[model samples]
Target: MPREHPLLPIVSLPFRRAGRDPMTCRYRCANSCAHPEPNASSTPYFGEILERSLSRRGVARAGALGLLVVGTAASTAGPAAAAPAAPPSGTTSTSGGRPGRPLPFEAVPPNTIDAVVTPPGYQHAVVVKWGDPILPGAPEWDLHRQTAEAQEQQFGYNNDYLAMLPLGTGGRRALLVGNHEYANPELMFPGYTGIPDAAQTAVMFASAGMFVVEIEQVERTGQWRLVRSGQRPYNRRITTTNTVFELTGPAAGSALLRTAADPAGRWVRGTQANCSGGVTPWGTVLSGEENFHFAFVGADEAPESMKPALRRYGFDTANRGGPSAELIDERFDLARHPHEANRFGWIVEVDPFDRASVPRKHTALGRFKHEGAATVISRGGHAVVYSGDDERFEYIYKFVSQGRMDRAKSRAARQRNMTLLASGTLYVAAFDATSAAEIDGSGTLPADGAFNGRGRWIPLASDTTSFVPGMTVAEVLVNTRLAADAVGATKMDRPEDIEPSPVTGKVYCALTNNSRRGADANPPADEVNPRNANRHGHIVEIAEDRGDHTATTFVWSVPVVCGDPQDPSTYFSGYDKSAVSPISCPDNLTFDSTGNLWIATDSAYALGGNDGLFAMPLAGPETGHVKQFLSVPVGAECCGPVISSDGRSCFVAVQHPGEITNSTVENPGSRWPDGDFGKPGIVVTWRPDGRRIGA
Candidate 1:
């Protein structure tokens, strides 16, 4: 259940005839919802403990804090964009993290112990991990009594958001998939058990979820691995306690998704807490069920128009004792099951190359906590996704898809572009301030001098209609954050991982920091999250409209506020923030086929320790320059950075390696690619002569 799933069905879909559709694209927010704080994973997902519990929403420009942003990725490409690949013999994107430098190596530095470092001619490996095997007659990992049928054919646990694809095009083999995102119980339960029977809770429900396998490309030096010897049939794994999902758009079989074993809300079994994902031009793999309210518990027995979105998406209603907060099943006790936590925060997708097909959950892309799903295809080939709801203030979404992307690679064009994410239309963004009354909170640059502006999107449901008014369209896709808080939207900051910009379709999000936006947040410092307690987290950018990747309206800004450029807030676009490379919170992003944006960081110990992977150069002169090529150890969190379409490998994942707090599994804090405990795998990184990691 990587990124869980929902939606109902539709099929005959070949880019179904649609109309203008393509609005919403930001997480929900108007009133409450977004907490973060408590760390050392009891389940917080997303890193540096969500940037030291949401980086204090900082910017308001305290003292001429700096920011003039302008845009461009290959750092001012001059040749109508992405058209300058001729340098090979040695290399050069320019310097390290600013103007013209697509991370020309040399930054790195942040450390902790236990490792996976990089940079300095790059080289990383590990590929297939956690229990390994993955399909083809299973068995192998036997960390003691582990057997949910041998952790369902192996390789699951931690590894977050990845993709790969390839398969044909002589790229040497691909598929890979990934996104296990949860499961560490003292290193996959060995003697470190608080009390777990029922077959070690069914091998901790088969180590959380999502797998796929298939790798290859070994001898090329961009190194891959796994393709385990033979048969392979696409390799599978699903998880959360087996697997079964459907729930398409307009709220599938709504009744808030009937549960007593699928009372027919379309079907739902498990999908674990998958985090981060996306990859679908016409080859499925969306995933996003981020921090699924740590599995269900629904306090206040919901129903009061769904009790303010089940207490603003932080469920787990009572039953709060210990044993690592157990609640095995009672449908996660939401007073005996309250809409199975509305059948999980969705955006599933999956198809990798159809192992046996069937895997959806679209709900027109509403239900929050999604934090992943990138797409971007419209020149009429419809598709356009892009999500982010990794808690705190939530609200950023997008879903277009009324089918349409048959760039034929057949298999009925990958089963009609995998039903283009079930059905579409489901916006949500608002930002309109050139200086909303001169944003106060102070972090400062709004005399129209630019915090940038104009944003729209709105919608709320459409695949069958219900522009949110009084609900229904399955309560606006199962309470999509109270239908973007009854239509006001806006609130962002903790957005986390948005994408789109293979070569400037310009989306790039990662607001990843928002220690409550001050004025006592609930609705504070707007101007599209102008920062108040916002520590170090920024990078907005948008663009849309004429570059219409669906477009409802846009023109955003922010170009990297992230921190440490001698702390006068930090901006990067006007370049010279001492030449970029401090970064913080930014979270996952991708984009290099030439648009260069990489980035990873989920917490930045001020500018010292772990959490790394940065690149930036969205187009010439290092657009909002960033640099650090790779870091990741002492309690990891760099998550699937993907990048490999001949760009020469890059992968990532490494989540929760040696997760922290009391260590465990025999005193382990992080052993990295290996040493012991703390699993979470997949690394890759390349450029050992093959070139192109940061070159």
Candidate 2:
């Protein structure tokens, strides 16, 4: 096999425990791993509660298999049967595997190759990339001479979330919306040690936000190309330099959210650290603002009343100076404007169809380092959203709209449905384990032979109502972590992305690695997060009671405890472990039309290779059989991971390619898509024969 970058040398550097290189840790999340875990509250870990509950209930190991409703058919009994053959038309299944089809393509083997390695018969290509011109009148990208103006007009940097919505029939054209998570100047500049002036810092800020570009599907093929030279009216750029977002919900105009720039507390200048996101049922996009705390300064001088909330969100309350963004935008100066930090860290909703529409930050979602917001309408017609706070020992949250969705296909209906997120009841998750006595922080199966249990969604706030004592509705939404801590929400191991299977209505959460688990002063592993010093994170499957997304109660299971197949601690939903590809640090997740779970990884160095995308069937005999479909180049984290509506194409954002400690643009680590200097971008893969992606 030919190497992706046979001429370029692959530099090996020491990485932090999060599996991210030091440079990625610094720029992407402000070296969050280096700081002490922010969740110091005494809320019992999920595993501890599970253990105590089971002790009182007594052991009932036999017939427990009857309770597992995951992908198994009720009539079949025992394990799920093999999926039936695909129909002659070869369309993908959208109902979460009610009529499941078999996985077709053979799995790709793991390797350290510096390229976008795909399965046989599949082809991949770079779509819009960093510095690519999306807006008209934007100058071509120059590697050496980057200007703040040009960066604002061009594609933003380090694209994370991706959403492709069809514009016409047969998927001929669509709008491709991407989230620019953050910027790495060391990889962008020729010799960047640090920002020397405001101009350079402005360029970095302009490169961090979101971009919407129109793309056309290649005639008679599964691939799609960017619409560069046409009447692309939707092509737009949103950056920290100029884009202003509206603050909505109960806390929008509260005194705690007000700042000098916006006395009404209803508007914010921009968004940064826009990580993984989801495409809403109404065709809008929801982007998570993860790690936004890193951009601010003067937290130490902030008022004593706000210090605890700020510190709980990972704001460095000890820091006193040196925030380059404060030079251009005074909002970064938290001491002068302490409430400005509250203006950020909310779930941002954007309309991809309306370029002129102002994006909104929904305070009802309950602010935190949101990993992503995936929505699934409840059986009752209300919109149900699931989000995870992306930090060690944080909690998972859910929001149920007070109003039902207007299903009519009109601009007014869309606008009305968009307001659903603005008024909702926010709830945090509290899990109860069944086999607590069997769990010993060894990642081992319990006496019942499964890591499964019951859980409930603990309500925190609704409109102007607060459920927690001594906190108002505004305090509950803005200072959510403290409220959850007070209410005894279960602590999770860095829950990143929570997505519901459109087919089964079963929610899957990607629990990224937590190195502090079982360490001194930290909680130990439980059934849901069943690993001590967890390097290879696990995936949790949640089934709301009676298959209702609006239900407060649920049953949960850990189907995939990720790691090398050879490791005894690993499990893949009872499938033959030897046949599964090694996966670690599961990050962003999506579903192909066939209801197969598609996972994009970050910090997969635990598996001794580059991070890539993997597909796993949720139903049939192949359930829990993990297979690698594609791998990004060296030093890049696989993100976005939007599968086309037809399931013919898989799009992933290859972020921070060639990023390594002490390597500047002139001397990079990996030359990926271009085989030149490293530039983060989006890549799409599909079979040349036009078959459904990953079979």
Candidate 3:
């Protein structure tokens, strides 16, 4: 029989040693529990576990659950039929799929320990890079001839998130917004040392980080290219020194947001370390501020009372000085700018359609180490956004707007739609399992057939109200973790990317590996995280009641437990273990037109292979046929696997190229898309015959 739920040990069953292979034991237990009539409280949880186990055994939940529920009904009605065959690979159809054409690339290149390269019949290009020009009369980039003033107007380094939105007319032009993540002085500056003053003032300026450039796109032969020169009217640059963003939502003008520069909390100087982001249906761009902890210092010396909130947010509780005190910018010294850290870690929204629009930082989303935000339009027309805090033991959050969506697709409607995100209610998830209470640290199946349960979205704050008893709405948004703590929200294992399955409207979250899971004396195993030392990670599926994205309660399950298929703890919706690609450290996620989920990996453990992108169907007979679509080279993470609206092209960002140890420009380990040296860049892949990608 399946084991007990992790959290409630009282419901657990004794684990048996079934030979050397754990997969066999897991499989056998699931198959044996095909038909179980547990109590009502445990039925739902058991059903989820059973479904997961059967899925790993290659049995569809509908078929397995139907058999369990109806029993001899099928036999009485008619003779049992053979199980349906799995769909042929590459047979799925997406929006751009058409007849009589081959796929973009037959398959991605084999796993590599180095940098990025595309399959044959595909080409990659660097649209823009650090120090590139974005505004009129901007000076060309000169690494050796650098100045902070010039760097302020030039493109920033380490572009993470990218969004391209169309401008007036039939897609002839567009605006591209790119986030400048943390600066890599060693990689960006020549002859760089820890010294504050470098040979290149421009490099120092670039290191502060900023958003730059709006390139005009020229419609080419069915593709788009950046126009080097033109009437570029909407082009603008937002840098670390001069750009001002307004505070909105719950934390706007709160005391926590106050700084020497903005005592009233109305404005902040600039955005920093922006990671991944989303584009709203209303044409605005949402950028997530991540890893803002390293930008400020001096928390260690602050009063003891402030330490709790700082520690929760990953800020230094011991020393307050940023990541590296000696090498960091002087501005990060908390003694110099006590409130600098508070200015970051927010979801900043920019109206790309309006050049003069001042971006607003929405506090309702609750600040932490934000990875990204993905929104799903609720059945009731409200927008529901899912976000993750990329720190171990952090929590996942969702925001549901009170305003309904305007179905009209007109420009005026789009303008109004952008405001939906600014006013919303934020919630954190808390999961509960129903099962035998005997399951302990071991990764075992629960008696209820699954490590599944129902969960509630505990509200933290709304437009003008706060659900947190003692804290104000501003406190709830600014120091969100404290608020979540008060409400006892369930902590998760590094929630990375939370996205909705376009086909089913069910949400999928990547709970990236957490070494701290099942730590000797910390937060122990829970239903959501069934494994003790969760090293390989898993995928969480949340289905809102009646398919309502704004629902307060929902059912959840772990569909895919990522690891080597040979490992018994790993599960893949019952697909043949040998037939699927081994995956780990799932981070960013996107969906193809055919409703297939594409997952991107960041850090790989077990030295299994290179980080890459994997695709699996969320519906149909081949729902769990996970396959490796692409891989990145050494020292790089596969990010931004966004398929085009037409499905004809797939774009991925190969970040931190040539990031291997003890390697420099003179002796780079991998010279990727460019032969001379490797530079992190965005790659586009399309069929040679111009057919839909992934066919």
Q: Estimate each model's TM-score.
A: 0.33, 0.94, 0.80
Order by lDDT, highest first: 2, 1, 3
lDDT value for model 1: 0.64
lDDT of 1 by residue, 60-114 (tens): 3211112211211111111111111221100112222222445567887655546
Considering every candidate listed, which one attains the maximal lDDT?
A: 2
Q: Which runs of model 3 end up more than 4 angstroms from their true locations?
A: 1-110, 119-123, 168-173, 195-224, 320-331, 409-412, 434-450, 605-608
Task: Provide the lDDT at 690 for model 1.
Answer: 86
Instruction: Write down the lDDT of every candidate, Cα atoms only.
Output: 0.64, 0.80, 0.60
Q: What's the TM for model 3?
A: 0.80
Per-residue CA lDDT of candidate 2, range 1-695, in tens?
22457633443567668678888998888888998999999987654675576574664422121121112110000000111111100111243323235567878787777788998898888888889999888899987789999998899899988877666444577788879999887888777768636767889989999888988888858788898896678888888768999998999999988889899999998988899877666667789998988788899999998898888998888877565578788878888889988877889998877788899999999999999888777778788889999999999999999999776655677678789999989999998888777789988897678888888999999997899999999999999999999999888989998877554577789998998998998988887788999998999988888888899988888888998989999998888988899999999887665667778899987667889999887667888889998988878999978776566778889999888777777877887777777789888888888887866
- lDDT value, residue 629 of candidate 2: 87
Best by TM-score: 2
Q: What lDDT score goes with residue 338 in model 3?
A: 58
Better of 1 and 2 by TM-score: 2
Worst 10 residues of 2 by lDDT: 72-81
